[model samples]
Target: MTTTVTTRTVRYPADGLTMVGHLALPAGTGRRPAVLIGPEGPGLSDAVRERADALAELGYVALAFDINGGRWIADPQEMLARALPLLDDPERMRAIGHAALDVLLAEPRTDPDRIAAVGYGTGGAIGLELGREGYPLRAIGTVNGLVTGRPGEAANIACPVWAGVGSEDPIMPAERRDAFAAEMQAAGVDWRLTVYGGAQHAFHHPTADHEVLPGVAHHPRQAARAWQDVLALLAECLPLGEQAGRAS
Candidate 1:
């Protein structure tokens, strides 16, 4: 049977910033597995909101959190101006992610112990930072955000990580991807990286209202393939009938 999915806006405070997030809840009683979504550098977009709703329809309480204090940026330069500094500051990323996690857990329908995080671009970096900060996540999925963490910090990641990126993405090039893989390997974490052939940066993002920058176009075929990979990761790691443990 198909269950109803409900969505709402949630306002919260994080690191002196008033964050606004989209919360999606599945129609059911008691606790259910939850997902935390991090939007790209452009902040929370309609596509990200829709992803949350889709997760809810699949019986996962979902929250697509804000970055940039609720501003959805369209200018590429403006987005880089806001995102570059935050990417360098892992603590700030963790602050925003944890704040969103708190709101997700506050929902009576959410199963606090069973949660995963999926993010894109700048948001994907935040999700990885949360994993590095020792958050108890069953799985971490990222697209175009294969950012390597601080030296030795990835040891804190307690769950498998699945990352996807466009093979032609200039932002996360071959050197950067190799570095990320090295980090994960050294930390003994189970991680996988999928490179979508001939795609550009942010290929998974749906077409936006404004024009995208060079090397940042959407690839529909690869986007669909990436989503399926994420769903597979979630199913394997956060199965509805089982509870996973936190990092030690």
Candidate 2:
């Protein structure tokens, strides 16, 4: 079935930076379950747009959020410098994410209770933060996201979470991954973490160059698998069509 998708740039609040995003809605929808997609780096990219389209094709209203003031950082060091501060201030980051969520919820075609979040890289961390902050998401998905903030914060999460990371991700080591998982377990949160062996950071971005991260290499196979897992989890929790119904 052919779906209608629209792209626009929106400014958040007064004096806040303008965010460029794409909104995709399925045909014949009063209000549909929405998926808020966070970008991997400083801003939105075409790759993220493709993912949003995929979600929309599955019968959802998908919004790809731009969090970096609509600027692109092609340099890894520059990107890190910009993202590191966000990791340090979880509250501020959460507010930014919450703002984006508010935008999604405000959309007339979005079902507030059935909203879900999915992010990559820094965006992944934002997704986890939103989930931990009781954002009313049906499910949350994170990819190669660093663990920030205190472990106890996981107690606030009220929905199932699925996290995907590369076993060889230099940015987020395997030991840290285990520690994060342990912390979530201790907090009694329903969470699952998948580490793809031999894959590196940004493995899902086929166009990403290895030189971009020096030693990191993208594994197309693992990336494909991770995408499938994310979609499956969302489907299980949010479903589509009449199955979604009205979120309670």
lDDT of each: 0.89, 0.79
TM-score of 2: 0.92
Which candidate leads the pack in lDDT? 1
Candidate 1 error regions (>4 Å):
208-210, 243-248
Candidate 2 on 83-200: residue-level lDDT in tens?
8887777886788788787778778888787888899987888888887776778888989885755758888888888889988888788787987788778878888999898888
Return the clash pairs for model 1, or none. Answer: none
Every candidate's CA RMSD: 3.5, 2.4
**Best model per TM-score:** 1
In the range 1-248, model 1's lDDT, one tens digit per residue, is 66798889999998688888999988767678899999999889899999999888887889999997788888889989889998999998999899998898899888888899999998889999999999999999999999998999999999999999999898899999999999999999999999999888989887832267877888889999999998899889987656324211
Q: Report the lDDT of model 2 for residue 125.
A: 85
